[model samples]
Target: MSFDGLVTRAVTYELKNKVIGGKIQKISQPSKNDIVLSIYSLGKSYKLMISANNNEGRVSFSNEKFENPQNPPNFCMVLRKYLNQSKIIDIEQYKLDRVIIFHISSIDEMGFDVSNKLIVEIMGKYSNIILTDDNFKIIDSIKRVNNKMSSVREILPGKNYNFIKSDKFNILENFDKDIYYIDKKTPDNANPKELLYSTYLGFSPTIANELCYRAGIDTRVNWGLVSEDEKKALNKNIIKLRSKLLENDYTPTLYKENNKFKEFYSFRLRHLQYEYKKYDFISEAIEEFYKVNKSNDRLRQIKNDLERKINSHIKSTKKKITILDKNLSKENSMELYRKSGDLLAANINKISKGMNSIRVNNFYDENKEIKIIIDPLKNPWENVDNYYKRYKKLKNSISYAKKDYPNQIEYLNYLLQLLDFVERSDSINDLDDIKSELISNKIIKDSSRNKKSNKEKSKPKHYITINNSHIYVGKNSRQNDYITLKLAGKHDYFFHVRNAPGSHVILKTDNFNENDLISASYLAASNSSLSNSLKVDVDYTEKKNVNKAKGSKLGMVYYENFNTITVDLSDKPKDLYKRIQ
Candidate 1:
């Protein structure tokens, strides 16, 4: 994007047709690494930008606007001191390089006629603009490269003025230089494309490609592959590119479709009829490429993560179904005991109603008579039939529990498994899958309202660690029940802080020594309500000994046997054991 050569050529043509006078109306530094000059010539204002940014640095009459800094930097101050209100005498290019030297004549503070020069170099990373006095002594540069930052040539004040490298091809005034340069042999083993690109001036990458493509020769082909015909084609492309450069005819036509740049293809001004919206082509190309690449990467990561989550959900759901099927085969002894109690009550009711035989002793002061009586039966087998009815009803109830308990368990297990998957989900798609499953199973009445939370909800209270193989404290009432009764093994030692709302800790083993009890108690102390203020008091006992109150909340329990121990809440509960998985 070096437009210095083009601008120089345009200025040379304009110098012949217009008044030979121009004055710098404004000087500003719009960025940390750029300067703008507003020059007035022939009653028209031209805003020229000279940038020393690491990339996209060039000198051209820009149509774009920039925000100027309130306080100029030191480099800006130095340029303004010498170049303000200076008259432009000439604008010239160095040999054939992208360097542009602006010659200005002005009166100094001493009221003496003086000449000063400002040089704009449009090299990629090494770009800079240097200011020099009447004697060609360097004043300063936009970027001062030192040994620490760069190993290349350093640009500093008080040095003699010189170009970093000369471009040999910008020799419009020298006929001999142009005619003899093409016959020169390039370096051995050089890529034909690379040699053509660097040796020929003002050749864009696309034009270079067109040259190689038309010749049926690879750009990366070795120098030895350069036959007479291929060389002739390359030479032709070079001359054409240079002609355009000398004419200052760089009205760039981007190969854009749907407002996206396809490529930079060669097109004549007449061939391009479409109204293409203009942009800072160099900057836009780089920025859009990065933006598109980043979006694609994010999309790829989301797809991979979703795939992993779905597979894990499927495996876990199948496991829960298998567990439900296994638990269904267990005999419900507690339910059977309740049914037996009901049967005993029914038989007693029949005797009281005189439907069955009964024996009673009436106590009196004078005499107590013991009598056995039976009601006259409509049928002799009625009493036997009645007893069998009660027994059969109890048996039938138990059979019903046996027949349907497994199915109910499977249904409940599926609900819980799906809830887990829903909680683990992050994006909308994952939530949608969970919502669909919930609706299919009738777990939720309304699928639209099945989302977990729009506002943040409190997290689950219980956490299990493999380090000590213990269930740590619960954060709330619901988690207390979940960890103590549901997740805890029968043999796991349970601990609680006496008379305190704390977690029920399960030590994962029954045969624990005094040290294990103390360690678990410490964990119970750290996660309690009193954790911030004082050392905690803990009580512990077997879970079997703890009983839930008849009307108590889910986690509230009353115990028949327990012991108390006080522990400091100094140690972090999570630091107890090293291993965790």
Candidate 2:
């Protein structure tokens, strides 16, 4: 949200200095809304990334690598046709707005020298990349806007190019007059900082707040109630800001709070409450901030998706178990059906053909008298035969259900463990391995089978303890299977959270001390969903004692001869081992 006009100006300034005389060597469209240009300048190669994405529209020199599409998009082809091998003559911004122009010199199809212009508009939803002739006639745009889409302007090929009109004057050019006008137009209840940014060009709310803070004025106070002395202080700070812009005296800085990126500015943001990290270039600041933000966003999305899927499986499996238990309960009453059949047979001699009911001695229960209901249409012998058949069917059903009950419960536990694994996953590859495991076990279908397979097998996380012992933690079911079954030796130690879903941690040494065992148990609890709990019970055993269940899902194992250790989850080991992978 802080990528406003001021940041755009800073980016343009940085690009102009680096790529003005550079020749465009290659052009790539990695995504539909983004393009990357490779420029060879000053004996170095620079990658300039321009994006028109609605949420993350930006233009910066990026160090991140992107995968290119097999075939270029139409917009990329148009740019390559006109701008390839062209030398950048100049770079300029339009009136301190979020619009950049790259003037290029090259040859035309007529074998004569010609010039072209590439314009980048960094407005949030209306961002675009447009190419035009030297006379500002549009050739093509990354996104087309017809008459129906926008009433203000239509960006189409063969149409004349124009900048979006704005009522606010450039801050650097009309500093004094614009300040006076803002002061005049300030509403009675409006915050001065808000009024300043809303009524000026190239001034974001962050910069406006900084100006207010430097002037010793409360940014939240009403502008109309400000003292004359405060007004004078504001005017002085605005002049200082104007001077900085004019002299190109910018110290690009990024602010971070609680180890998360908060915002970045072209100049120092004194009003923000965070540690300021200065960067040598504005592009570097922008790239670093967005890279971490994007990675966090992607990780969250993957976790949510996996959680939803695993939870659905857990719900459905529990429902099925409930149904099976009900059926088994009914099957348990099979003995009553057999008894009724015997009672009917014994009373056949005393009953008539039209009798619907009879009272007979219950031979099974101390010869007590009992009431037996019969089908009126069938003879007594036929009635007894029907009851006998029903009894046999119920008895068989009970057998089958008893055989299936344990497997169903085991499957439910497996799904729950998967949910815990997904919630604890810290990387994209871990999620991928879990997804692959689900697909292989027929819990979910592999929808990406047709896509290229470039993913490497996820390896166990290796760590070194303070006493020079190696510990491996499984991040997903596939990794868990590998670590417990193949990589670990028979005498190695295995640890897991007791009666909970967690990672399988293996300490790969025969002579580990009690401290090593405690460290490994702590790790097992930390990788579980109950990591926030104050105390957790962990079970440890030798690898030889851990046996996989036959015909069970991956990572499902049975173990005995294990010792339980209660660990405080809040107490992290001081000399925790460094993770090797």
Candidate 3:
């Protein structure tokens, strides 16, 4: 949503410098709504990505790789026929709007030179990619809108290409005049930030707020209520911004809050209180923003699914344990059954076959009188035998329930830990590792059965301590198993959050200093769900002391000879070591 008109302008400027006169060497449609062009400019290959996806629509020079289909789609084939080996003549934006037009010159099938145009509209849900001839007649569009979809514009073959009509004035063309008009036309109750974006082209709400902030005016205040001094400041700021745009002075920046990426802008954003990650080129910033956001979105979706499944299983396991507990409670009366049977046998002489019941003293309870029911037809001996048989069965049930209860509880804890791992996963490969673990444990069905093979195992995150000792942290249970059992040396130290779900961090050296141990502990705590806790207990032990339980889940290990170290979860060490990818 931050990819507004200014971003488009910046991208156009970047492309004008990099891709103008470049040859389109190859074209690929990796997705239905996306196209990637391989261009060779100044002996360097650049991938220009154009996407029409409703959620992530934009144009940028991308470093991300996409897998293309084995057979090219019809749209890809059409683009190849018209634009293959074509030279980019010029790149321009449509009147400061979020639409970019590319002019190309290429030879036609008849061996005659021809000119064509490619238009990319970066409007949210209505974004599109259209190819037209020099005459501005539509050749083809990635998405065709007919009369049924829209009456204002029919983007089909043979239709003439035109910019969508809007009432907003272009800010770059008539800045002073437009500002004067905006000041007069804005109502008293209108928010200054909203007025700027609604009345002018190329200004997103973010940029509008930035302008108001730079002018030292409250963006939430009514535009008509702005003081004369503030009005002059606003005018000066707008003029300065216009000059920067004309001069193509773009300071592309990506903003983050609490270490999470939020948005990117074509110019510096003073209104937004966030950590800024500046980039030399706007294209690079855009690419990084989308790449990280897309990956996070993907990982989140996978994690949610896994979390839901694990929670459901946990509920079911709890229900099973509850039922077992109830049965065990009933089984606890087995001793009473045995006593009743003995009393009946002792009272056989006083009871007759015709009697339905008899009162007898309970010798086991200090001769207290109790009622004893008997099957009159079976006589006392037969009743006693049946009681003993029932008691034996209940005793066996109690024994089995007692043994199974702890195992079920442990399994439940294991699942909770797995859920924690999924929530903490940082990358797609980490999620894949967890998915594999779930499938292997029969906790979930393998949905990727149609794939040729399982993905290669993901490696653990590796780091070096300040003492130059290596520390490997597991991103998931599969990686945890690897780090603990295979990758670790016998004398190497292993650290984990005590009695909590966290990463298994292995310090891979026998000669580690106190700083190395503390650093490893901090790394373990940071990767856990309890990282927000003020203090976390981290347990460390030699790798040889930790052993996986027989038939236990992967990464479920028990250890002895471990020392507990309480660490401040917020004490993240700096320059501990560079992470090895």
Candidate 4:
């Protein structure tokens, strides 16, 4: 939703001015749904992001880098073989529409001149990327639109590709002719934006409102009939749009539509402004837009995961409680024996009071009164032996239940946290981290379909480059152990957040400059639970003093020779973290 027509227009403007004539240095399809074009333009390289999965199917230019898959997909290989080193001769669009065409020129394998066309159709579900020869004969397409695939157009290779014509009203050409009729038909009582929207094609309600607001023409003018003056006002608005698009004389005027929320506004053709209140830069906004959408998608999966786990755990706990209750409630065989034995020994007084009374089975200790009956069918001798046997069974069951009850409670709490994290996660990496933690804690089992031969991979060690030196940090428990125990030299200084969940920072060398050591300490504090604290306390010590506890969890190490000091939390540490190149 963050990427509307406005974003597409801005991106188009930038591409037209900066990258249309650039040569395609590299063509990489890092993912099945994404294509990254590395172009050399004006003595510099630029990346253009073309995502078929996007709702609007944009081919926007981006500065964000995308990693190539380890084994490139078939489509990527095909593109690289055909489109690499091609010159982008021209970029054009059809009739002021969302669809765009890039004409690329390249040489054949035999070093002869050859040319191809990369067509991007951004018409929602009908969107596609079609590659064709100079003659417009389709060579291939990212998505093959055929008679079976689509009823509108069959875009199979070897056939000449054609642009989809606008069958709906053409606002510009028919404006003058229909203005009088449209004005006369406009309802006396209706929203102005809606009236314009109903009359225009390819213009959203937002655009219609802007157009109406800009021209000072009331869309709610008398519907039954219109005066000559009203018709002229409508014609004036239509002319404005024609001039902006056809004449290439766009005068973009941004309006604070909602005075309350001024930060959010629609820009009419404008240069890229890098200032956004919530985002660090315009690029950040784009990144956040994609990240938020992706997170929303993953949120459903994570919720489903938590629901299944909690429900399964609850079902299991209920079953265990039922079994325990049954065993505990069953009649005690020894009760009668105890009474008979007392009677035969002529100790009736001993049988009175609490002497011969039966005790409830230990299995039902949690609900003691649930089991209060004795077996009446068995003889005293048989009951005595049976009672002893039953007693032993209950004792064992009670011990097991006691241990299991706490574990179940703990598991449920952990699952709730997992759910909270899933719902609040802002990026895929955050979800991955949660999954990693769940796996490490054994809160979730691995997929039964997973290959057993593959070893459980540990979180990879991360390094931050500070002062041109690699500062190692532990991403997880085992990695923390390795970093502190094996990776850190004795002379190296260790930094950690004081009494907070955080990564263990190891300043790679024992001999370090005072400023570098201080920088490492600041980073350790910032990457902790108290990151937002006004003053973060960081613990520092020599690597030799830190020791691994016996049978302790990974990343849970003990240190004897450590000291902590509180330092004011400053944004300056972000600059240091950003140097991790």
Q: Model 3 segments beyond 4 Å from truth?
A: 174-176, 338-358, 363-368, 373-393, 449-456, 466-470, 487-494, 507-517, 520-529, 570-581
Report the C-alpha lDDT of model 2 over 183-283, residue by residue, as the tens digit.
Answer: 77667798888877877787778888888888888977788788778888888888887788777888999998865788988888888889989999998
The sequence of per-residue lDDT tens digits that candidate 4 reaches over residues 1-581 is 32333334444555677787798988888676678899998888988877776463667657666878778877677677778998888887654456677888889999998989888776666677888898999988777777987777789879899877655455545455455666555566656566655665555555665565565555565343444565566567666665665444433332222211122222452222323334322333454455545556566677577557645765676677667555444435334334333332332222222223444423323533322233456544444455556556666666676666655544444344344444544445555555666676776776656434343454434555445555776554455677889888887878888766676888875346765666777767766656678888889988888887565455666676887866677645444544431
Q: After superposition, how far is residue 346 of candidate 2 from its true place, in Å?
A: 2.8
TM-score of each: 0.44, 0.94, 0.89, 0.61
lDDT of 3 by residue, 507-548 (tens): 987577878878898988888878889999899999999998
What is the C-alpha local distance difference test score of candidate 3? 0.87
Q: Per-residue CA lDDT of candidate 1, range 1-581, in tens?
A: 22334433443344323323788878999998889888888898877667777755655455666777779988888878888888988777666555777888899889999898888787778778889876778889888766688665666788777656645454355434432365476655877666555655544454555667766667777777678777776566556656765665444334445433343222332223444433333233323433344344454464454345544555665665565445444335434333333443434444443444443333221323333233345333454454456556555755665665554544443333343334333344444444444444454445354356453323333443434355455444455667777777666667876664455676776456665676778767765545574677888877777766554444566676778888876655454454231
Candidate 4 lowest-lDDT run of ten: 256-265
Q: How accurate is candidate 2 locally (lDDT)?
A: 0.87
Clashes (N, CA, C under 3 Å) per candidate: 1, 0, 0, 3
Which window of ten consecutive residues has the lowest lDDT sum in model 1?
A: 263-272
Task: Tell how far residue 53 is off in model 3, in angstroms.
Answer: 1.6
Candidate 2 positional error at 65, Å: 2.7
Report the number of the highest-TM-score candidate: 2
Instruction: Between candidates 1 and 3, name the one with more favorable lDDT.
Output: 3
In angstroms, how far off is 126's CA in candidate 2? 0.6
Query: lDDT winner among the candidates?
Result: 3
